[model samples]
Target: MPSQEALSAQVGAVYTTSTGAPVAEPYAAQRVGLTGPLLLQDFHHIDLLAHFDRERIPERVVHAKGSGAHGVIKVTHDITDLTVASLFSKVGNEAPLTIRFSTVGGESGSADTARDPRGFAIKIKTDEGNLDWVFNNTPVFFIRDPAKFPHFIHTQKRDPQTHLKDADMFWDYLSQNPESIHQVMILFSDRGTPDGYYMHGYSGHTFKFVNKDGKFHYVQIHLRREGGAKSLDNDTAQRLAGENPDYATEQLFTEIEAGKFPTWNVFVQTMTAEQAESFRYNILDLTKVWPHKEFPLRPVGQIILNKNVQNYFAEIEQAAFSPSHLVPGIEPSADPVLQSRLFSYPDTHRHRLGVNYGQLPVNAPLAPVSNFQRDGAMAFNNQGFRPNYQSSLAPLQYKRKAYEDVKHEIWLGDANVDLSYVTELDFEQPRALYEKVFSDTDREHLIYNLSVHLGNVKSPIVKARQLSVFAAVSKDLGDRLAKAINHPSVEPLAVKPATEAIRYKLKAA
Candidate 1:
């Protein structure tokens, strides 16, 4: 290896301080004498140490470990009849894009092959502005109520006292909230571990596509892999998790680097206002999915990830996405989960990145940005000399347009607020999934997967409650799970250990 000075000279790169002052000898600290104490006024030495101390920012609460790549989204079909979003205005219309896929529940260094839902976030740089589609691999979510989100997440994470995953914590939340069954079913299925980043699909609750005529359609966006979706079995997923924790993460980068880019064929399922009114299930319910038979998907566009990022920290780590980052013609629906995210996404970005996170090159809109806001942490460009406020002296140009009436919803029954009702309706869809959607083999795996985790739940009451929830989905499923875990009925009695209960039951039989 060449010496620092020799390397810098050879590369023709000048050594400079963080603020761009010339530094002839950054390797050596200023000294009082040849063998005396070092001087404190060495700005370069102090700066280097200071920057190192603050090098790490806080990891995201979820979807922390991720990989991203540069890409393009090309409109493939006419969607102008549904949406005015310029990103899909014409058949040949194209936009520069960046996509980051991640696992949902793990910390920054967790295994990429963990059996968890994958995040499918994309940022499109359109002439109008930046539009971020922050979605997850699964169409439906675990819980629709925003109030249960933090509690549910805590259960999925390590227990506060033990600093280890608690099975009771996981099952208690789900059992108490039956609405989670639909998503829980999906999570435990083989689909939990996709073959690769692009092997699954995405949805951010349901949204709406409004045309120029103010005609609107409640829509669900699905990005299907060019090839049909595929998944890993439990044994295979666990094996990969141990052998190469960064398996999926590395595969994405390696493929893109080798010029073997991946693409997803985009599609949308639309519902008119009248259809929404008479729909079989509430369109706002994130716990349920719109059946394909009811509303078939329409081909719309394509997402092609062609280029890999040169710097992960600058492009991938610093990339911020929010469900609220919507362009005109694309708007959020009344889905409770989506409603909560519109605020929480941007708020987390402010905390994780900075107040001016949008200004970052990876996140900044392709369209020229001129706003009244100025002066916050990491303010790269302060809009230079122009008025920071709405001034009579020199007001900024405005492009005022009529607000889309299609985006508006008239609330019925009450105005203040209402508690989300939990009813038998929630179980209808999960039951259908178990009875109709999953094959016999798939059902066996689902039950086995649930048993593996539920068996670890120590509390009899919690375990019983969970089995009851499973039974609500299907009587046979519940009976099978109860036998699998050997969990005693929810009667007033001593709660035996799982293995002991199984042995005792067998002996009694």
Candidate 2:
């Protein structure tokens, strides 16, 4: 290998500090003598050491490990009737996008093939502003209530005492919270370990698309792989986890690098407010999914990941996404989880990235940004000489859209908040999934997967509670799970009491 000087000379490139100060002796540090202590005046050496020490930013509390790529979202279908967002103003409208695929409940060094939901976050640079769709590989989540979020995440993480993944701790929380059975079933299935990152992505949260007329439709977004979705069996996933932990990340990068761009067809299942009222399950329920039969998927467009990130740290790692990053016409629903996320996502970004995280190139919107925010740790764009408050002397022009002034929906009910109770309705979908959706082989795999993890749980009480929850979903599923785990018998349990009892009911006025 050529020396630094030789390489620089051959390339005719000057070596400089971050501030562009040319450095002649790039390799040597100034010192008192050949073997003496380093001089404090050696700013270059000190700067290098200081920068190296602060090189790492705070990793995300969740979805710490991820892979990302540059892409484009091409609007193939006209949805102007549905949403007034300019991202889909006309057919063939294409917007540049950045997508991050990640494993939830994992540290930065964790294996990519872990049996965890993949965070499918996309930042679409639209003409109006940046619209972020922070989705997941699965259509449903473990819990619907936002209050249970931290507790549920804690269960997924290491136990406080042991500082290790504790099966007893994991199942104890899930067993007590039976509403999680739906997502739990999906988690333990073959779908848990996806075939690399080539899996379907779902919004999970129901949103709204408001038109110019102020009419709105509740929507659920889905991203289906162009070919089809694929999954790996437990053995294969485990093998890859040990052999090559970065298998999924490598596959995505190499595929894009080879010019074999993976495409996902976007679709939405929409329902009117009137329809939502009569729907079997609450639209706000995160654990439940709208039946495709009732609300069919309408084609939207295609997302083609054509380019790979040149620098992971700068381009991908620094990129921030939030469910609240909505443009006009696209609005969040009343789902408690989604509602909570609107605040939490940006708050987490502020804490993890910085107060001025939005100023980062990857996160900054395509549209010109004019805001009152100024002066933080890293305020790249401080809007110099501009007043931070509204002023008649130099008034900022604000373009008000149709939806901006429209009062689309109104809530006239008493404020009532509590953890959602587990009812028979909670188990209906999971039962259907096991009985109707899963093939014989899929069922076998599901049973095996559940057995592998749940079997490790040493507490018989926790194991029995979870089995009962399964039995409630389906007697066959519960029996199979029990037999696989070598348990004696399985009995369906009544609806378990939630962490907190319903304190108040929503009474319509």
The model with the greatest lDDT is 2
Best by TM-score: 2
> How close is every model to the real structure, measured as TM-score?
0.90, 0.94
Q: What C-alpha lDDT values do all the predictions have?
A: 0.82, 0.87
Q: How many clashing pairs in candidate 1?
A: 0
lDDT of 2 at 384: 87
On the 0 to 100 scale, the lDDT of residue 194 in model 1 is 84
| Candidate 2 C-alpha lDDT tens digits along 1-509 | 22345557669678888889999988899988799999999889999999999998889899999999999999999999999998888999999999999999989989999999999999999989999999999999988778888998999999998899999989999999888888888989999999988799999988999998888899999999988988999999999999999999999998987789999999999998888765766677788899999999999999999988867888899999999999998999877788899999899988889899999999988898887877999987898898898989999998887764433334311122444566666788998999999999999999999999999999989999999989988889889889999997778977543222232223222
